[model samples]
Target: MAHPVRSDAEVLSVASEGVYHRLVLSARDAAPRVRPGHFATLAVGGPQSAMLLRRAFSIHRADVEAGTVELVVAERGEGTRELARARPGDRLDLIAPLGTPFPLPDGPVSALLVAADYGSAPLLALGEEIKRRGGQVGFILGAATADRLYGVEQARALTQDVLVVTEDGSAGLQGLVTDPLAQAVKAIDATVVHACGPMPMLREVSAIALGLGVRCHTAVEAAMACGVGICMTCVLPVVGEDGVSRFVRSCTDGPVFDGARVRWDDIGTVPPDLEGAAAMGGQG
Candidate 1:
Protein backbone atom coordinates (compact mmCIF):
# COMPACT_ATOMS: atom_id res chain seq x y z
CA MET A 1 0.00 0.00 0.00
CA ALA A 2 1.25 3.49 -0.77
CA HIS A 3 1.43 6.10 1.99
CA PRO A 4 -1.55 8.48 1.98
CA VAL A 5 -1.06 12.12 1.01
CA ARG A 6 -2.72 14.90 3.00
CA SER A 7 -3.23 18.17 1.15
CA ASP A 8 -5.59 21.05 0.72
CA ALA A 9 -7.40 20.41 -2.59
CA GLU A 10 -9.16 23.16 -4.44
CA VAL A 11 -12.68 22.47 -5.66
CA LEU A 12 -12.41 22.41 -9.43
CA SER A 13 -16.07 21.76 -10.06
CA VAL A 14 -19.29 20.54 -8.47
CA ALA A 15 -21.79 19.51 -11.10
CA SER A 16 -25.28 18.21 -10.33
CA GLU A 17 -26.30 14.81 -11.64
CA GLY A 18 -29.91 14.07 -10.81
CA VAL A 19 -29.91 13.64 -7.04
CA TYR A 20 -26.17 13.08 -6.83
CA HIS A 21 -23.23 15.47 -7.30
CA ARG A 22 -19.96 15.00 -9.12
CA LEU A 23 -17.10 16.76 -7.33
CA VAL A 24 -13.74 17.31 -9.02
CA LEU A 25 -10.83 18.39 -6.84
CA SER A 26 -7.29 19.49 -7.67
CA ALA A 27 -5.30 16.84 -5.80
CA ARG A 28 -1.89 16.76 -7.46
CA ASP A 29 -0.07 14.41 -5.10
CA ALA A 30 -3.01 12.13 -4.37
CA ALA A 31 -4.45 11.66 -7.85
CA PRO A 32 -1.34 9.97 -9.22
CA ARG A 33 -1.34 7.44 -6.36
CA VAL A 34 -4.98 6.36 -6.60
CA ARG A 35 -5.99 2.82 -7.48
CA PRO A 36 -9.47 1.61 -8.51
CA GLY A 37 -11.29 1.17 -5.18
CA HIS A 38 -9.26 3.55 -3.03
CA PHE A 39 -11.13 6.35 -1.25
CA ALA A 40 -10.44 9.85 0.10
CA THR A 41 -11.58 11.73 3.20
CA LEU A 42 -12.49 15.41 3.24
CA ALA A 43 -12.99 17.61 6.31
CA VAL A 44 -16.40 19.13 5.71
CA GLY A 45 -18.39 22.01 7.33
CA GLY A 46 -15.79 24.64 6.43
CA PRO A 47 -13.76 24.59 9.68
CA GLN A 48 -16.24 26.63 11.71
CA SER A 49 -18.99 24.02 11.99
CA ALA A 50 -18.86 21.47 14.82
CA MET A 51 -18.63 18.55 12.35
CA LEU A 52 -15.11 17.35 12.97
CA LEU A 53 -15.32 13.88 11.44
CA ARG A 54 -14.08 13.66 7.87
CA ARG A 55 -16.46 12.38 5.21
CA ALA A 56 -15.16 9.36 3.32
CA PHE A 57 -15.93 8.95 -0.39
CA SER A 58 -14.76 6.48 -3.00
CA ILE A 59 -12.48 7.88 -5.73
CA HIS A 60 -14.85 8.03 -8.71
CA ARG A 61 -12.07 8.90 -11.12
CA ALA A 62 -8.45 9.94 -10.88
CA ASP A 63 -6.49 11.74 -13.58
CA VAL A 64 -2.76 11.61 -12.90
CA GLU A 65 -1.98 13.85 -15.86
CA ALA A 66 -4.63 16.39 -14.88
CA GLY A 67 -3.60 16.29 -11.19
CA THR A 68 -7.20 15.80 -10.10
CA VAL A 69 -9.54 13.33 -8.38
CA GLU A 70 -13.30 13.03 -8.58
CA LEU A 71 -15.94 11.89 -6.09
CA VAL A 72 -19.63 11.01 -6.35
CA VAL A 73 -21.64 12.49 -3.52
CA ALA A 74 -25.19 11.83 -2.33
CA GLU A 75 -26.54 14.49 0.03
CA ARG A 76 -27.85 12.17 2.69
CA GLY A 77 -26.76 14.30 5.64
CA GLU A 78 -25.40 17.69 6.62
CA GLY A 79 -21.78 16.77 5.95
CA THR A 80 -22.48 15.65 2.38
CA ARG A 81 -24.83 18.58 1.86
CA GLU A 82 -21.91 20.85 2.72
CA LEU A 83 -19.72 19.03 0.22
CA ALA A 84 -22.42 19.19 -2.42
CA ARG A 85 -22.64 22.95 -1.95
CA ALA A 86 -18.93 23.42 -2.61
CA ARG A 87 -18.16 25.58 -5.65
CA PRO A 88 -15.10 26.29 -7.78
CA GLY A 89 -12.16 27.95 -5.97
CA ASP A 90 -13.14 26.60 -2.51
CA ARG A 91 -10.58 24.45 -0.74
CA LEU A 92 -10.98 21.52 1.61
CA ASP A 93 -8.50 19.40 3.55
CA LEU A 94 -8.16 15.99 1.91
CA ILE A 95 -6.39 12.70 2.44
CA ALA A 96 -6.35 10.45 -0.60
CA PRO A 97 -5.73 6.98 -2.05
CA LEU A 98 -6.69 5.32 1.23
CA GLY A 99 -7.81 1.70 1.82
CA THR A 100 -7.30 -1.44 -0.28
CA PRO A 101 -8.23 -1.22 -3.96
CA PHE A 102 -9.94 -3.91 -6.02
CA PRO A 103 -7.32 -6.25 -7.36
CA LEU A 104 -6.98 -6.52 -11.14
CA PRO A 105 -6.49 -9.76 -13.02
CA ASP A 106 -3.04 -10.99 -13.98
CA GLY A 107 -4.14 -11.28 -17.60
CA PRO A 108 -7.12 -10.40 -19.78
CA VAL A 109 -10.30 -12.20 -18.68
CA SER A 110 -14.05 -11.82 -18.72
CA ALA A 111 -15.32 -9.91 -15.65
CA LEU A 112 -18.61 -8.53 -14.42
CA LEU A 113 -18.88 -5.35 -12.31
CA VAL A 114 -21.97 -4.80 -10.15
CA ALA A 115 -23.21 -1.77 -8.25
CA ALA A 116 -26.24 0.12 -6.93
CA ASP A 117 -26.91 3.86 -6.89
CA TYR A 118 -23.75 5.91 -6.51
CA GLY A 119 -21.83 2.78 -5.58
CA SER A 120 -21.11 2.58 -9.31
CA ALA A 121 -18.49 5.28 -8.70
CA PRO A 122 -15.45 3.12 -8.02
CA LEU A 123 -16.48 0.24 -10.27
CA LEU A 124 -16.46 2.60 -13.26
CA ALA A 125 -12.79 3.29 -12.69
CA LEU A 126 -12.16 -0.43 -12.22
CA GLY A 127 -13.77 -1.11 -15.60
CA GLU A 128 -11.41 1.34 -17.30
CA GLU A 129 -8.40 -0.37 -15.75
CA ILE A 130 -9.62 -3.83 -16.80
CA LYS A 131 -10.20 -2.69 -20.39
CA ARG A 132 -6.81 -1.02 -20.49
CA ARG A 133 -5.25 -4.35 -19.52
CA GLY A 134 -7.00 -6.10 -22.45
CA GLY A 135 -9.80 -7.62 -20.34
CA GLN A 136 -13.49 -7.59 -21.27
CA VAL A 137 -15.83 -5.95 -18.73
CA GLY A 138 -19.59 -5.82 -18.19
CA PHE A 139 -21.63 -3.71 -15.79
CA ILE A 140 -24.90 -4.02 -13.87
CA LEU A 141 -26.06 -0.81 -12.20
CA GLY A 142 -29.17 -0.70 -9.99
CA ALA A 143 -31.12 1.79 -7.90
CA ALA A 144 -34.56 2.51 -6.47
CA THR A 145 -35.45 4.68 -9.46
CA ALA A 146 -34.15 5.87 -12.78
CA ASP A 147 -32.75 9.13 -11.47
CA ARG A 148 -30.81 7.29 -8.81
CA LEU A 149 -29.07 5.00 -11.28
CA TYR A 150 -25.63 6.34 -12.30
CA GLY A 151 -23.13 5.64 -15.06
CA VAL A 152 -25.49 4.11 -17.59
CA GLU A 153 -23.89 5.99 -20.47
CA GLN A 154 -20.45 5.60 -18.98
CA ALA A 155 -20.87 1.85 -18.74
CA ARG A 156 -22.19 1.69 -22.30
CA ALA A 157 -19.09 3.51 -23.51
CA LEU A 158 -16.86 0.96 -21.80
CA THR A 159 -18.82 -2.13 -22.84
CA GLN A 160 -21.97 -2.86 -24.80
CA ASP A 161 -23.12 -5.33 -22.13
CA VAL A 162 -24.31 -2.74 -19.59
CA LEU A 163 -27.39 -3.79 -17.57
CA VAL A 164 -29.52 -1.39 -15.55
CA VAL A 165 -32.19 -2.32 -13.02
CA THR A 166 -34.43 -0.02 -11.07
CA GLU A 167 -36.92 -1.24 -8.46
CA ASP A 168 -39.68 1.02 -9.79
CA GLY A 169 -39.52 -0.21 -13.40
CA SER A 170 -38.56 3.27 -14.51
CA ALA A 171 -35.33 1.97 -16.04
CA GLY A 172 -33.94 -1.02 -17.93
CA LEU A 173 -35.38 -3.79 -15.75
CA GLN A 174 -37.81 -3.89 -12.87
CA GLY A 175 -36.63 -5.58 -9.63
CA LEU A 176 -33.29 -6.08 -7.92
CA VAL A 177 -30.08 -6.09 -9.97
CA THR A 178 -29.40 -9.60 -8.66
CA ASP A 179 -32.50 -10.83 -10.45
CA PRO A 180 -30.51 -11.07 -13.66
CA LEU A 181 -27.02 -11.56 -12.18
CA ALA A 182 -26.70 -15.30 -12.53
CA GLN A 183 -27.90 -15.24 -16.09
CA ALA A 184 -25.68 -12.32 -16.93
CA VAL A 185 -22.65 -14.07 -15.48
CA LYS A 186 -23.34 -17.20 -17.47
CA ALA A 187 -24.10 -15.19 -20.57
CA ILE A 188 -20.78 -13.43 -20.43
CA ASP A 189 -18.95 -16.50 -19.09
CA ALA A 190 -17.59 -14.24 -16.35
CA THR A 191 -14.62 -15.52 -14.41
CA VAL A 192 -14.60 -12.77 -11.80
CA VAL A 193 -17.15 -10.43 -10.20
CA HIS A 194 -16.55 -7.05 -8.52
CA ALA A 195 -19.26 -5.18 -6.62
CA CYS A 196 -19.98 -2.12 -4.46
CA GLY A 197 -23.34 -1.29 -2.87
CA PRO A 198 -25.54 -1.51 0.21
CA MET A 199 -24.78 -4.51 2.43
CA PRO A 200 -27.86 -6.48 1.38
CA MET A 201 -27.21 -5.97 -2.31
CA LEU A 202 -23.54 -6.88 -1.96
CA ARG A 203 -24.40 -10.02 -0.03
CA GLU A 204 -26.72 -11.17 -2.78
CA VAL A 205 -24.21 -10.32 -5.50
CA SER A 206 -21.46 -12.21 -3.70
CA ALA A 207 -23.68 -15.23 -3.18
CA ILE A 208 -24.73 -15.30 -6.83
CA ALA A 209 -21.20 -15.01 -8.15
CA LEU A 210 -19.71 -17.53 -5.75
CA GLY A 211 -22.54 -19.98 -6.38
CA LEU A 212 -21.59 -19.91 -10.03
CA GLY A 213 -17.93 -20.65 -9.12
CA VAL A 214 -16.78 -17.15 -10.03
CA ARG A 215 -14.32 -15.23 -7.84
CA CYS A 216 -15.93 -12.25 -6.14
CA HIS A 217 -14.70 -8.97 -4.65
CA THR A 218 -16.92 -6.55 -2.72
CA ALA A 219 -16.41 -2.96 -1.56
CA VAL A 220 -18.36 -2.36 1.66
CA GLU A 221 -20.01 0.82 2.87
CA ALA A 222 -19.50 1.22 6.58
CA ALA A 223 -19.98 4.19 8.87
CA MET A 224 -16.63 5.63 9.89
CA ALA A 225 -15.80 7.96 12.75
CA CYS A 226 -12.29 8.30 11.39
CA GLY A 227 -11.36 7.52 7.79
CA VAL A 228 -7.95 6.41 9.03
CA GLY A 229 -7.55 3.32 11.23
CA ILE A 230 -7.53 5.27 14.52
CA CYS A 231 -11.23 4.74 15.29
CA MET A 232 -12.76 1.32 15.89
CA THR A 233 -16.16 2.37 14.62
CA CYS A 234 -15.79 0.61 11.25
CA VAL A 235 -14.45 -2.69 12.55
CA LEU A 236 -16.33 -5.78 11.32
CA PRO A 237 -15.97 -9.53 11.54
CA VAL A 238 -13.92 -11.08 8.74
CA VAL A 239 -12.63 -14.62 8.42
CA GLY A 240 -8.96 -14.84 7.63
CA GLU A 241 -7.28 -17.42 5.39
CA ASP A 242 -6.29 -19.48 8.45
CA GLY A 243 -10.04 -19.95 9.15
CA VAL A 244 -10.12 -17.74 12.23
CA SER A 245 -12.63 -14.92 12.47
CA ARG A 246 -11.30 -11.55 13.66
CA PHE A 247 -12.46 -7.96 13.80
CA VAL A 248 -10.86 -5.87 11.05
CA ARG A 249 -11.08 -2.15 10.46
CA SER A 250 -12.73 -1.41 7.12
CA CYS A 251 -10.96 1.94 6.74
CA THR A 252 -7.49 0.41 6.76
CA ASP A 253 -7.81 -3.36 6.36
CA GLY A 254 -10.30 -2.87 3.56
CA PRO A 255 -13.13 -0.98 2.07
CA VAL A 256 -12.47 -3.73 -0.53
CA PHE A 257 -12.19 -7.42 0.49
CA ASP A 258 -12.84 -10.92 -0.76
CA GLY A 259 -16.59 -11.46 -0.76
CA ALA A 260 -16.25 -14.98 0.60
CA ARG A 261 -14.11 -13.85 3.57
CA VAL A 262 -16.49 -11.26 4.97
CA ARG A 263 -18.95 -12.36 7.67
CA TRP A 264 -21.82 -10.46 6.08
CA ASP A 265 -24.53 -11.69 8.42
CA ASP A 266 -22.31 -11.04 11.44
CA ILE A 267 -21.59 -7.45 10.52
CA GLY A 268 -22.54 -4.69 13.06
CA THR A 269 -22.20 -7.21 15.93
CA VAL A 270 -19.30 -9.18 17.30
CA PRO A 271 -19.92 -12.84 16.71
CA PRO A 272 -19.29 -15.25 19.60
CA ASP A 273 -16.81 -17.16 17.42
CA LEU A 274 -14.64 -14.10 16.80
CA GLU A 275 -10.98 -14.38 17.87
CA GLY A 276 -11.25 -11.88 20.76
CA ALA A 277 -14.99 -11.88 21.20
CA ALA A 278 -14.93 -13.52 24.61
CA ALA A 279 -12.30 -11.10 25.92
CA MET A 280 -14.09 -8.16 24.44
CA GLY A 281 -17.26 -8.98 26.41
CA GLY A 282 -19.13 -10.65 23.59
CA GLN A 283 -21.47 -13.48 24.60
CA GLY A 284 -19.18 -16.37 23.87
Candidate 2:
Protein backbone atom coordinates (compact mmCIF):
# COMPACT_ATOMS: atom_id res chain seq x y z
CA MET A 1 0.00 0.00 0.00
CA ALA A 2 1.15 3.57 -0.62
CA HIS A 3 2.71 5.06 2.45
CA PRO A 4 0.92 8.23 3.34
CA VAL A 5 2.79 11.51 3.85
CA ARG A 6 5.15 11.61 6.73
CA SER A 7 8.54 13.13 7.44
CA ASP A 8 11.25 11.36 5.46
CA ALA A 9 11.93 8.00 7.10
CA GLU A 10 14.87 5.70 6.76
CA VAL A 11 14.16 2.28 5.27
CA LEU A 12 16.39 -0.74 4.88
CA SER A 13 16.06 -3.27 2.09
CA VAL A 14 18.00 -6.05 0.43
CA ALA A 15 18.98 -5.46 -3.18
CA SER A 16 19.89 -7.82 -6.00
CA GLU A 17 23.54 -6.82 -5.62
CA GLY A 18 23.65 -8.82 -2.33
CA VAL A 19 23.90 -5.72 -0.19
CA TYR A 20 21.66 -4.63 2.60
CA HIS A 21 21.55 -0.84 2.57
CA ARG A 22 19.79 2.23 3.83
CA LEU A 23 17.84 4.45 1.46
CA VAL A 24 16.57 7.99 1.83
CA LEU A 25 12.79 8.23 1.93
CA SER A 26 10.37 10.38 -0.04
CA ALA A 27 6.74 9.98 -1.01
CA ARG A 28 3.76 11.75 -2.59
CA ASP A 29 3.57 14.13 0.34
CA ALA A 30 6.83 15.83 -0.51
CA ALA A 31 6.45 15.59 -4.24
CA PRO A 32 2.91 14.94 -5.27
CA ARG A 33 3.82 15.84 -8.80
CA VAL A 34 7.48 14.80 -8.91
CA ARG A 35 8.69 14.28 -12.44
CA PRO A 36 11.63 12.52 -14.02
CA GLY A 37 15.23 13.81 -13.86
CA HIS A 38 14.72 15.25 -10.36
CA PHE A 39 16.75 14.36 -7.24
CA ALA A 40 16.76 14.47 -3.44
CA THR A 41 19.16 14.77 -0.50
CA LEU A 42 19.60 11.90 1.95
CA ALA A 43 21.11 12.15 5.40
CA VAL A 44 22.88 8.94 6.37
CA GLY A 45 24.91 8.21 9.48
CA GLY A 46 24.81 6.61 12.88
CA PRO A 47 23.86 8.40 16.09
CA GLN A 48 27.35 8.63 17.60
CA SER A 49 29.13 9.99 14.54
CA ALA A 50 26.11 11.42 12.79
CA MET A 51 27.21 13.46 9.84
CA LEU A 52 25.51 16.83 9.54
CA LEU A 53 25.42 16.96 5.75
CA ARG A 54 23.25 15.30 3.15
CA ARG A 55 24.21 13.34 0.04
CA ALA A 56 22.47 14.13 -3.21
CA PHE A 57 21.09 11.29 -5.36
CA SER A 58 18.74 11.34 -8.29
CA ILE A 59 15.48 9.51 -7.82
CA HIS A 60 15.64 6.26 -9.74
CA ARG A 61 11.95 5.59 -9.45
CA ALA A 62 8.95 7.05 -7.68
CA ASP A 63 5.83 5.05 -6.85
CA VAL A 64 3.19 7.53 -5.86
CA GLU A 65 0.58 4.94 -4.96
CA ALA A 66 3.08 2.97 -2.94
CA GLY A 67 4.54 6.16 -1.48
CA THR A 68 8.10 5.08 -2.07
CA VAL A 69 11.22 6.35 -3.89
CA GLU A 70 14.28 4.44 -5.02
CA LEU A 71 17.87 5.31 -5.92
CA VAL A 72 20.75 3.33 -7.43
CA VAL A 73 23.90 3.93 -5.38
CA ALA A 74 27.38 2.54 -5.75
CA GLU A 75 29.66 1.83 -2.83
CA ARG A 76 32.31 4.46 -3.47
CA GLY A 77 33.38 6.14 -0.22
CA GLU A 78 32.99 6.12 3.52
CA GLY A 79 29.39 7.34 3.47
CA THR A 80 28.37 4.91 0.79
CA ARG A 81 30.20 2.11 2.54
CA GLU A 82 28.20 2.82 5.64
CA LEU A 83 24.98 2.77 3.66
CA ALA A 84 25.96 -0.57 2.18
CA ARG A 85 26.19 -2.08 5.64
CA ALA A 86 22.69 -1.25 6.64
CA ARG A 87 20.48 -4.23 7.53
CA PRO A 88 16.87 -4.83 6.71
CA GLY A 89 14.59 -3.18 9.32
CA ASP A 90 17.09 -0.37 9.84
CA ARG A 91 15.78 3.14 9.32
CA LEU A 92 17.38 6.11 7.55
CA ASP A 93 16.82 9.87 7.46
CA LEU A 94 16.40 11.83 4.26
CA ILE A 95 15.55 15.25 2.80
CA ALA A 96 13.95 14.77 -0.50
CA PRO A 97 12.13 16.12 -3.62
CA LEU A 98 14.81 18.81 -3.87
CA GLY A 99 16.20 20.65 -6.92
CA THR A 100 14.56 21.51 -10.22
CA PRO A 101 13.54 18.82 -12.71
CA PHE A 102 14.56 18.52 -16.34
CA PRO A 103 12.31 20.48 -18.64
CA LEU A 104 9.95 18.52 -20.88
CA PRO A 105 10.09 19.55 -24.52
CA ASP A 106 7.04 21.64 -25.36
CA GLY A 107 6.01 20.10 -28.67
CA PRO A 108 5.62 16.64 -30.15
CA VAL A 109 9.18 15.43 -30.09
CA SER A 110 11.66 12.68 -30.70
CA ALA A 111 14.02 12.59 -27.70
CA LEU A 112 17.35 11.00 -26.94
CA LEU A 113 18.53 10.05 -23.48
CA VAL A 114 22.25 9.59 -23.05
CA ALA A 115 23.74 8.12 -19.89
CA ALA A 116 27.21 6.93 -18.92
CA ASP A 117 27.94 4.56 -16.05
CA TYR A 118 25.68 4.91 -13.06
CA GLY A 119 24.29 8.12 -14.52
CA SER A 120 21.70 5.94 -16.17
CA ALA A 121 19.56 5.73 -13.03
CA PRO A 122 17.62 8.94 -13.45
CA LEU A 123 17.02 8.37 -17.14
CA LEU A 124 14.95 5.26 -16.52
CA ALA A 125 12.18 7.20 -14.86
CA LEU A 126 12.59 10.00 -17.33
CA GLY A 127 12.13 7.63 -20.23
CA GLU A 128 9.08 6.07 -18.64
CA GLU A 129 7.59 9.51 -18.07
CA ILE A 130 8.26 10.54 -21.65
CA LYS A 131 6.57 7.41 -22.91
CA ARG A 132 3.60 8.05 -20.69
CA ARG A 133 3.35 11.50 -22.26
CA GLY A 134 3.26 10.03 -25.74
CA GLY A 135 6.76 11.10 -26.72
CA GLN A 136 9.25 8.77 -28.39
CA VAL A 137 12.38 8.00 -26.35
CA GLY A 138 15.72 6.55 -27.39
CA PHE A 139 18.62 5.70 -25.12
CA ILE A 140 22.39 5.54 -25.55
CA LEU A 141 24.58 3.97 -22.85
CA GLY A 142 28.36 4.11 -22.57
CA ALA A 143 30.69 2.32 -20.24
CA ALA A 144 34.37 1.64 -19.86
CA THR A 145 34.06 -2.15 -20.35
CA ALA A 146 31.62 -4.99 -20.08
CA ASP A 147 31.98 -5.29 -16.32
CA ARG A 148 31.42 -1.59 -15.83
CA LEU A 149 28.41 -1.49 -18.12
CA TYR A 150 25.31 -1.77 -15.94
CA GLY A 151 21.65 -1.06 -16.73
CA VAL A 152 21.72 -2.01 -20.40
CA GLU A 153 19.10 -4.70 -20.02
CA GLN A 154 16.94 -2.50 -17.83
CA ALA A 155 17.22 0.43 -20.22
CA ARG A 156 16.44 -1.87 -23.12
CA ALA A 157 13.33 -3.07 -21.36
CA LEU A 158 12.19 0.51 -20.85
CA THR A 159 12.74 1.80 -24.39
CA GLN A 160 12.62 0.17 -27.78
CA ASP A 161 15.71 1.95 -29.13
CA VAL A 162 18.77 1.20 -26.98
CA LEU A 163 22.35 1.59 -28.13
CA VAL A 164 25.34 0.44 -26.08
CA VAL A 165 28.95 1.44 -26.57
CA THR A 166 32.04 0.49 -24.63
CA GLU A 167 35.63 1.62 -24.65
CA ASP A 168 36.92 -1.94 -24.76
CA GLY A 169 34.37 -3.13 -27.33
CA SER A 170 33.45 -5.77 -24.76
CA ALA A 171 29.74 -5.80 -25.51
CA GLY A 172 28.38 -3.26 -27.95
CA LEU A 173 29.98 -0.79 -30.35
CA GLN A 174 33.75 -0.69 -30.54
CA GLY A 175 34.09 2.95 -29.54
CA LEU A 176 32.81 5.34 -26.93
CA VAL A 177 29.08 5.86 -26.35
CA THR A 178 29.37 9.25 -27.99
CA ASP A 179 30.18 7.60 -31.26
CA PRO A 180 26.78 5.97 -31.36
CA LEU A 181 25.26 9.18 -30.08
CA ALA A 182 26.77 11.13 -32.95
CA GLN A 183 25.52 8.55 -35.38
CA ALA A 184 22.06 8.48 -33.89
CA VAL A 185 21.85 12.24 -33.90
CA LYS A 186 22.71 12.22 -37.56
CA ALA A 187 20.34 9.40 -38.47
CA ILE A 188 17.26 10.64 -36.63
CA ASP A 189 15.62 13.99 -36.26
CA ALA A 190 15.66 14.21 -32.48
CA THR A 191 14.08 17.41 -31.28
CA VAL A 192 15.66 17.45 -27.81
CA VAL A 193 18.49 15.77 -25.98
CA HIS A 194 18.88 14.78 -22.33
CA ALA A 195 22.24 13.59 -21.12
CA CYS A 196 23.92 12.82 -17.79
CA GLY A 197 27.42 11.48 -17.62
CA PRO A 198 31.04 12.57 -17.27
CA MET A 199 31.65 16.26 -17.98
CA PRO A 200 33.91 15.66 -20.94
CA MET A 201 31.27 13.57 -22.66
CA LEU A 202 28.53 16.08 -21.96
CA ARG A 203 30.63 18.92 -23.33
CA GLU A 204 31.11 17.10 -26.59
CA VAL A 205 27.42 16.20 -26.79
CA SER A 206 26.47 19.77 -25.99
CA ALA A 207 28.65 21.02 -28.81
CA ILE A 208 26.98 18.62 -31.19
CA ALA A 209 23.53 19.65 -30.01
CA LEU A 210 24.39 23.28 -30.55
CA GLY A 211 25.57 22.61 -34.07
CA LEU A 212 22.38 20.75 -34.84
CA GLY A 213 20.21 23.55 -33.47
CA VAL A 214 18.51 21.11 -31.07
CA ARG A 215 17.86 21.86 -27.42
CA CYS A 216 19.86 19.82 -24.94
CA HIS A 217 19.83 19.41 -21.17
CA THR A 218 22.61 17.98 -19.03
CA ALA A 219 22.98 16.81 -15.44
CA VAL A 220 26.32 17.55 -13.80
CA GLU A 221 28.06 15.96 -10.85
CA ALA A 222 30.19 18.07 -8.55
CA ALA A 223 31.64 17.64 -5.09
CA MET A 224 28.88 18.61 -2.71
CA ALA A 225 28.95 18.66 1.09
CA CYS A 226 25.50 19.98 1.69
CA GLY A 227 22.66 19.05 -0.62
CA VAL A 228 20.87 22.32 0.01
CA GLY A 229 21.65 25.83 -1.21
CA ILE A 230 22.99 26.90 2.19
CA CYS A 231 26.37 25.18 1.75
CA MET A 232 27.38 26.84 -1.52
CA THR A 233 29.62 23.88 -2.25
CA CYS A 234 28.49 22.63 -5.65
CA VAL A 235 28.86 25.86 -7.57
CA LEU A 236 29.15 25.96 -11.38
CA PRO A 237 29.65 29.00 -13.55
CA VAL A 238 26.74 30.06 -15.72
CA VAL A 239 25.62 33.08 -17.68
CA GLY A 240 22.86 34.98 -15.96
CA GLU A 241 20.03 36.91 -17.62
CA ASP A 242 22.16 40.03 -18.08
CA GLY A 243 24.93 38.10 -19.88
CA VAL A 244 27.25 38.44 -16.93
CA SER A 245 28.82 35.17 -15.89
CA ARG A 246 28.09 34.07 -12.34
CA PHE A 247 28.17 31.01 -10.14
CA VAL A 248 25.15 28.86 -9.36
CA ARG A 249 24.83 26.09 -6.80
CA SER A 250 24.29 22.75 -8.44
CA CYS A 251 22.74 21.25 -5.32
CA THR A 252 19.79 23.59 -5.48
CA ASP A 253 19.32 25.24 -8.86
CA GLY A 254 20.48 22.20 -10.71
CA PRO A 255 22.43 19.15 -10.91
CA VAL A 256 20.44 19.71 -14.14
CA PHE A 257 20.88 22.70 -16.47
CA ASP A 258 20.16 23.79 -19.98
CA GLY A 259 23.06 22.69 -22.16
CA ALA A 260 23.30 25.90 -24.20
CA ARG A 261 23.30 28.18 -21.15
CA VAL A 262 26.07 26.40 -19.24
CA ARG A 263 29.66 27.65 -19.33
CA TRP A 264 30.96 24.28 -20.42
CA ASP A 265 34.35 25.47 -21.57
CA ASP A 266 35.01 27.13 -18.23
CA ILE A 267 33.90 24.05 -16.34
CA GLY A 268 36.08 21.82 -18.47
CA THR A 269 39.11 24.08 -18.10
CA VAL A 270 39.60 24.66 -14.40
CA PRO A 271 43.18 25.68 -13.60
CA PRO A 272 45.45 23.06 -12.09
CA ASP A 273 46.07 25.18 -9.01
CA LEU A 274 42.36 25.86 -8.49
CA GLU A 275 41.59 22.19 -9.01
CA GLY A 276 44.11 21.30 -6.35
CA ALA A 277 42.65 23.85 -3.96
CA ALA A 278 39.17 22.52 -4.50
CA ALA A 279 40.37 18.98 -3.99
CA MET A 280 41.85 20.05 -0.67
CA GLY A 281 39.33 22.43 0.91
CA GLY A 282 37.98 24.91 -1.61
CA GLN A 283 34.35 24.86 -2.76
CA GLY A 284 33.66 23.77 -6.37
Q: Measured by TM-score, how close is model 2 to the native structure?
A: 0.85
lDDT (10s digit) by residue, model 1, range 226-255: 988998999989999999999998999889
Worst 10 residues of 2 by lDDT: 1-10
* Candidate 2, position 166, lDDT: 82
Index of the highest-TM-score prediction: 1
Query: Model 2, which residues run further than 4 Å from truth?
Result: 1-8, 17-28, 31-33, 268-284
Candidate 2: clashing pairs of residues:
2-66, 10-92
The Cα local distance difference test for each model comes to 0.92, 0.72
